[model samples]
Target: MSDKQESIKQAAIALFAKRGFDGTTVPLVAEEASVGAGTIYRYFENKEVLLNVIMQGEMLRLEQSFKENFPYDRSIREQFSHLFIGLIRFSQENFESIMLINSHTTSRHLSDQTKCDYTSLLTFLSTIVEAGREQEVIDRDLPIEAIVAITFGAVVELAKCFNGGELTLTEDLLETLDEKLWRAIST
Candidate 1:
């Protein structure tokens, strides 16, 4: 959490997002961060370690965003809307983080703990769907895993489109996307 470490993390996120995990190099990240290549080693044990650090940091940020904005007292529909809006907002503001996460999750170097952490977000979403099912608000015909996969997949794809410049992340667009996703899972 020192300035040097943070700089390396930020640079890594951008590079990892643009060039991918395997495509990016430690020296390139060090140069982008304006630090000696050795400085990176001071913070991270190796390239894989640095990548994991960035992934874990982004995942934590995502979880914090959801926890801060989740509407626990609202109707299921409203809660879903809030969650969708939060995701879009997070992706818009932290494009590199989202891309870094997407890249890291697929990397073979990721540790089992990191993989579990990655799925933790999906598990949280499954719980929400489960709650809706209990309330007869969400379709109970599909398994919880399938429901979560479909919902999270749609959001991730839309975010990817925005990141790739195929679409813009606008308030109007988010509202429309939220409604569409809600209808897909709603009973």
Candidate 2:
């Protein structure tokens, strides 16, 4: 992508994260990106197109963060730790991206491909939960979807707290949160 396109993407993600899809407009994105409205149109056909592209890119980035240096040979508990830490790291580094993703994954403006991409990210986490359940490490009473939802809900709320200035996300705090989330889902 050119510098202009990247700037548009970054601006749109931040605006969408803060104001949401319906609240945001193409002209607004162009203003935030320091470009003309026509420039945004030159790159993205419409606001929906831009939103879908941003969602797909952000989802792919998140999935890659979990996959990077993932410990396949480790015990399920260790694997969970790795994934949890990966999420924390990604959220901290790309707060706007995470905010946009969490808020807009179910937007009516999302394309089918964007929905599929989001589902694939969930499937990756489900695979981990399924493995843990099979190994008798995670709670078997809960469905895979519930387990993933619980974990994500906890972490996402924690991220919100941190972003809202309600809590300081120190290393010690993160470790405690990770352990607490693990115990919540584990047997």
TM-score of each: 0.89, 0.97
How accurate locally is residue 118 in candidate 1, as Cα lDDT from 0 to 100? 83
Residue 144 in model 2: lDDT: 94
What value does the lDDT take at residue 116 in candidate 1? 85
Tell me the tens digit of each residue's lDDT in model 1 across 1-187: 7999999999999999889987899999999999999999998999989888778879989988987957898998998887778877788788778767766677898877778888897778778888999999999998998876686567677787887899977778888888888888889
Q: Report the C-alpha lDDT of model 2 over 16-88, residue by residue, as the tens digit.
A: 9999999999889999999999999999999999999999999999999999999999999988998898888
RMSD of 2: 1.0
> Worst 10-residue stretch by lDDT in candidate 1?
148-157
Model 1 shows how many backbone clashes?
0
Model 2 residue 133 lDDT? 95
